[model samples]
Target: MIVAPYMLKAFLCSVGLTWMRSRSPGAGISRSWARALPCKPSPAGVAAVVGTAAVPPCCFLQQGQLSLRGGLRVPPCAFSTLGWWMVGIPPDTAGTSSVGLRAERSPVFACSPMDLSELLKEGTKESHDRAENTQFVKDFLKGRIKKELFKLATVALYFTYSALEEEMDHNKDNPLFAPLYFPVELHRREALAKDLKYFYGEDWKEKIQCSEATQQYVDRIHHVGQHEPELLVAHAYTRYMGDLSGGQVLKKVAQRALKLPSTEEGIQFYVFDNISNAQQFKQLYRARMNALDLDKNTKERIVEEANKAFRFNMQVFDELDKVGRSLGEEAQDGGVPVHDGKGDIRKCPYYADKLGTAGPSCPFHAAVGLARQPLVQLVLAACMAVAAGAAAWYIL
Candidate 1:
């Protein structure tokens, strides 16, 4: 029987995602199954079948042959055309490979069971989500940030990065952490100092003191750098990669929210002068991290430490949230408003929460309520009636 092309594509994508997900820590897939599937199906090959580009590299169709790990090969035409070549292979003839291809079992193309970058990403995903959803981060994203709170947040970052960079400097030469060190590209302490100077003037150093939460985070960084130097990789990866990922977006939000100057003064901490291409630099950094000489246990510990770093950040955010509550100042106005392109005001989380509340905060709801008033309704109805009568007279 001929298998439909879409069916074959779906099967391949399912296999690809399964292999990719199984590589994460605590994935329930059996070790033998993971070894059998090998590297994720290459995006090009999967895209050729599925019409979307995603998934990491490994099995791919080259020239005319589809090459997968474990020495399994199939012609591109097998799935491209409607044929039984793919589906007709007997189960008994299929060897170690799961896709019914004869397994030749070569060791040359074998991939490591885990990469440090993927491990940290998957393991700390929950912690990252919690940190992002915290009230401070959510408010900042919505441009509801007060200038005072923003400056205090900058102060916290200055202290955190100062400690992190100091530790990174001491471990820069060590074999365990050396590959990941990129002072010019990734360090933010100097940039943060510039931001503080802009916000608090030349006496910024004396005006800003580390908050209790921030001090705890700094102490942890120092402790990790001094005693468990190898685990410093966790803090570096967590902070620098996260900053690189979200820095520009946050910078734009802060600039608009606080009405900061266009010269990039107060938001200097988010600007990476040395790194021209953040994406390529991040890929290079992850590659270097994967190349490190580390065992499974060490890698697990590093993932745990990265989660700890995320926790420390969340604690700092909580402290900022508490401080924001006590301040009498209103959140800055004239900030850029968030739009989801649907134009429905209720869709915005910030506006949705304030929708029916009394005040000028929700003008849309106020207008809606006014339209429902008997006097306003009567006036609107009279206007519509007059316009209809005028149209009728014109037609006559």
Candidate 2:
């Protein structure tokens, strides 16, 4: 009769434990003995077999190695195998057997050094910081967003996603980009269209036009999709990952600040209905991106393209800020304030370094208002001049 490998290993382990208990007084099986069972071959291509009275040539005992007959010896195993099980404990000479084995767990799937997901994240961190600090983003986070600007922003997103999704669809069949093509779960064009309709009425198509900044972004996406399809992964990773990470926070801010209905109108762009677990979906997407068969140069190019995507987003934000300034609408006060109980302005998502420190109430806006004042500007300029003069004098 043939026995399975695991079954054979189990039987050997049971026999070995019984023999050890009978030969050595007070020798008990350690909890780790189960994991250390010789189920697979060691690194030297030798199977660690347990036998009675005599052991194979591969099994020998030195100082602290496992032994079956006279002395305990264990052959070297792969790092992966060592990660799975603990090393065998040496027998005690004082008539007592105590097992000391340390268990270490290793990653199930070993990742390559040049993982695409990790590369993109580290490369775009600076760009991400700059994007978050944009005046338009800060205002939106503070619930100071105007309705007209918000509608315009939605229009921009609609056009941008329209172009991106079209390109993604075109390249879905390509091997290099096929694995990352998640149409149903990651696509946002349809959702953004619904948001546009809610904001611009049924004739939303006629009323909304793509801003120049958004047009530039759309043009780049189309170019990438048509000419350099491999680079499409960068744009996809930037937009989709950002949306999944911060979409809910932005949605709540918009809904509260705009006084939109609780039924989730005007913010469908942020609502990912198809994605039940956004975090898990993001992890899956990252894994797919990392699994793509791209060389080092292509990975670097992708990272560069992701930074360009961030720049495009920043330009769109700047354009929106300009339009918002022209509208002369009062900032809405419906945004949820992020604080650390001490009313720390730094913790506020709206806080930017250029906007100066916080004030007693609504510090971000207060700093912005103060900076905009002619007197405050002149005072700041004078202080800067005085500091420069002091430094020059000291140098001289």
Candidate 3:
């Protein structure tokens, strides 16, 4: 049967994903256990040994050949990237060695256990703190931002979590997702929906719109779900973990700043109803992540994807900051641009000094003159305080 490239890619990716998940911690069998089983070289030499009979035609056409783990002499095209992520392809000299092709076992998987959760925490600590200390974020934390701006931030989050949760549900049956699929425990879509109603009122769905940054973030989650669903693991780790950790702090800040009632009305998005102990739950979540049957390359890719997820969030913050700034400006007034095309969040005087970059010039003088107005002065003071605090935050 003829298949389009996208479909073929998706099919292969799914197969690979399934194959890898089948070896996860709770999955019936594991690689170490399977290695002890008896096996025979294929009659067709290396090709037959690798289960070439059940292999699809696309595998042969797209890739050269499949090499058995033992010493089977097959073509170079043992697996495509999709399959590569699924079933590991033997090295080039796999079968040529006197000992046949042996699956490359990761030290973390076999010998030294690695705490993926701790690694993520340590790897992302700086960026995570920086994001929290951004001028826009500090304004919200200090309750200095307007209710409308705060609502807008929630709106953006609504779009993002919607995409992520929907994709997770769609791919839940996949083995790679089985261990991590805690819809009751980690799902935030319904909570975010409640927040949207509280902020935008009953007609929230009709009125809410995504910013360009929010849309980009949504598109990225969808793209990964469609093409490389395995990477969703990383996205989940980046977002949900952050939500469970720093999100708790932000929840308290928001409730106080927004004067939200001590109920689920406004802060529903941050509440974890099923999880009584956030720290304990986080440990469980990390255990599932570390238990995933990912090879070294796949693990590396997951880490990279997590980093990308953080960068995506920073971009969303940048977009939100622009919207907040635009709230006070005159029709033709152009405020100082903060972000460059690159994803650097600390590009302005406030953040630049924090990052040790020379501060930008005084283009905001014209804008500051308008701040002399009564109502504008209050906001300007808050902005200046937020900026100075954010800059100093990096120093200390």
lDDT of 2: 0.63
Per-residue CA lDDT of model 2 for 1-396, tens digit only, reads 133344445545545554554333222223133234433332354333321111122221121222322242323221222112222222222221222212122111223347788788678878877877898987776678899889999999999999999999998778678767777667898888888888888999999888899999999999999999999999988887777666566776678788788888899887876665554355445645665668899999999998999899999999999999999866476545333222222222222222222222467755775665545555565565555555556655
lDDT of 3 at 67: 36
Candidate 3: pairs in clash:
46-72, 64-77, 65-77, 69-101, 70-101, 71-100
- Cα RMSD, each candidate: 16.5, 22.6, 22.9
Question: Mind sharing the TM-score for model 1?
Answer: 0.60
Worst 10 residues of 2 by lDDT: 100-109
How high is the lDDT of residue 317 in model 3?
Answer: 76
Residue pairs with colliding backbones in model 1 are none
Alpha carbon deviation, residue 253, candidate 3 (Å): 1.1
Report the lDDT tens digits of candidate 3 across residue range 1-396. Answer: 232344445545544555555555334244244333333222343222222221211112232343333343223211212222112222232222222223331111111224455455556666666665666765543435556777888898889888998899888766565557767777888898899898888999999898898898899999998888878998888777667765665565566556678775788987877655454355445645654556677777776777777778778877778878888732221222232212223321111213223233244744654544444544444555555555555655
Give candidate 2 regions above 4 Å deviation: 1-113, 334-396
When sorted by lDDT, best at the front, the candidate numbers are 2, 1, 3
